[model samples]
Target: MLNRIIQQFGLQVQSINEVEDSHSSTVYKCTLSSGENVFLKIPYTKLKYQRELEAYEILKGRVSIPDMLEYWTGDEDCPGAFLLSELKGKPLTSKGSPTVAFQVGVLQAKMHTIHPPAEKVLNGIRNEYTNWSHFIENQFYSFAKDVEDVLPPQLYKRAIEKFEEMKHQLPPPDGPSFVHMDFRPANIIVDNNKVSGIIDFESVRFGSTEMDFTKLYRDFLCLDTTLYESYREGYNSIRTLIDLEEVLPFYQFTDAFNSIGWCKRRGMEKNALFLEENVSIIKNFIL
Candidate 1:
């Protein structure tokens, strides 16, 4: 397999080391004989591979995505993959510096400025714009079975009722724009307190910018208040920041519920327990 990749890219391979923490794709760090380095991502799904390639094409100069060196759509003998210029950075950690968090916000705000693509991208929230109430309600309804399967039926029923009532009072999305739907710390890369790049573009879609902040609330806010404040400040510097306080809880509920469903399906009992705890936390915000 290494030989095939080396031959395909016409490179004198020095080493191919598997990258950790890549779930959807088999990622490798390749060091060429010339001492230059590149990263290869072979996606398990063809659609995701194509989306990542297209995302890079669209974001090449505007954002801090890695430079694409080569893209291959594989045959039966191999899998589809792409090579990118090796970026120097580490994933954002729990103790991420304020600068890193601020930069994350700035970068995310910049991405939100990019116009939505001609073709609608898949979004967690329903794409229809006429009614946000219907959107959230419908979204929860679709997950009703999964919610029941993973959570206590009484809690699930009560949560649904609360969500239905609150949905009507929520405001409509301001507009659709390019959003990194999975904009969490892990997806951001930093070096020396500065952001070098953002990875994992398969979840890029046209949606409300508020959706991105849900991750900030779920994954970063409690870990570091400074990160959240700095991020909010930085984002407000570029564009009108969404009032995340108004929408964050609802989005967090959806994310947590979806995670629980995934965990239950995979028989990840511990993971499901953690997510159930999160749901309990989110319920307070709604009720």
Candidate 2:
């Protein structure tokens, strides 16, 4: 069916090999008959497809995102596929060097400058969060509900109590900045110690700038003091750094709660270590 989609585009493909990355999409590395390389991504859900398509449409040339050569939404015959220019690098593996972190910081701060489409422009994007506290409150309660069976009863009760207390202290972010909701090392592409591309926009949203930092903090920033400061320096080069001390813990706790709910939904056994780590984070907040 996807092959037929390619045929419909009049794109003569030399080969298509699977790239195992996203859980919700079947991604492929394809070589064109014209000797160019591209990715063929067919997302499982239409919502995922729409988000990604709109993201690429908005973010082309402004940032280091994969170029969307062409895309076709699926009909009853087949699911949609995005034929994107093959971004030239692999996903980041380790906690990157100070240089890499700095570049990532600079890029992220720049990305936040591009505001998401207005509500009238984008009708059904679920992530176009208008009110900052409202978005957090909704996610907190929603994920909390999901994790009730996953977390210990005592911890679950405390999570509810802790969230109510913390909700009042939620910081007002610098305006409605465009956010890459899953900004992590895995979604970053590096080549020659520089960030070449940022991928995975299915989770892109309009929200607080700080919301983007939680995952980076979890996966990258906490690993080393030098890296954190370097990242701060780079971000500050664009805009003043927010008071992370005031904001990080609140978002971190919520991030951890979201992870627990996610692990339970996906399955707890294979994600045992991740679940344990997030549970520990919850413990720190509620203890």
Candidate 3:
């Protein structure tokens, strides 16, 4: 099947390296006859394929996204797959300096400024809500239900009640923007201290900037103060300054709750406990 796909691209396959294999997708790093490298992503489902294809089609010139060469749904000759130009960089590791965070912030700001027509953007679960407060309120409660069994009952009750109070205090909904709903270091490729490309757009949707900023803060801020500060500095240069005082702790609670549920489902007890601890810290803030 791979050989057939390679022929469709008019390339002679020199070798193929399996880079990722998971329940959702299989990815390969392919070396072509001309010694050029390309990446192929074969989604386990058709729905995943469509989401990624829509992203490539819409985000081409506006962002530092990969160049899609070809996309095919499975048939007799070929299986479901999409091929992209291999970006020249490595996935970011925690070892890199915090300066990269500033660059990421700039890229995110640029991405958010892009407002395509509503008709053009695909309908996404997150994007459906015009009211940001409603979205977070619903998500908080929904996630509460999901994590109820694993989360301590007292903490869970406290979180739900506090969120109810906080929801009313939430500011008016921010304007909709193109949001990379899963903005994390793992999804970014860096070279020479600059973000060369952003990948994995399956979670791309129209939503609030808070959705993206949550990850940057939750993951990178603890490593270095400069990471969060520089990111904010870069972002403010393009967009209006975000009220970090208001949004950070609120979104931290949201992310922690979400992570706790995920860890419980995967039977990752230690990670769940870590997130549970963070949830406790957030609960203290509310008190």
lDDT of each: 0.73, 0.82, 0.71
Best by lDDT: 2
Rate residue 229 of model 1 by lDDT.
89
| lDDT per residue (tens digit) for residues 1-287 in model 3 | 66766766676788998884132467889988899899888775666667778778778898898899887777754447888898788876676566787777778888888664666646432363376676677766676766787657887787777667665665655558877777777777899787897887766666777667777665665578777788778777788756867766667767777766666655666465666675576567555
- Candidate 3 stretches with Cα past 4 Å from truth are 1-25, 74-80, 118-126, 269-287
Which candidate order results from sorting by lDDT in descending order? 2, 1, 3
The 10 consecutive residues of candidate 2 with the worst lDDT sum are: 120-129
lDDT by residue for model 2 over 1-287, one digit each (tens)?
Answer: 76687786788889988886465678888888899988888887777788888788788878899888788878975557788887677787665899988998888988888876665366324544567788888877777777998887988988888888887887666657778888988888898788898988877777778788898888888989999999999988987778888888888989999889888887899889999999999998778
Expressed as tens digits, the lDDT of each residue in 72-187 for candidate 1 is 88878565778788778888778787777788888888888876556645333233434544655665677676768766777777767766666555566856767676787777
Candidate 1: regions farther than 4 A off: 1-6, 76-79, 117-143, 269-287
Backbone clashes for every candidate come to 0, 0, 0
Each prediction's TM-score against the native? Answer: 0.84, 0.90, 0.82
CA error at residue 52 for candidate 3, angstroms: 1.9
Residue range with the least summed lDDT across 10 consecutive positions in model 3: 120-129
Q: Of models 2 and 3, which has the larger lDDT?
A: 2
**Which pairs clash in the backbone of model 1?**
none
lDDT of 1: 0.73
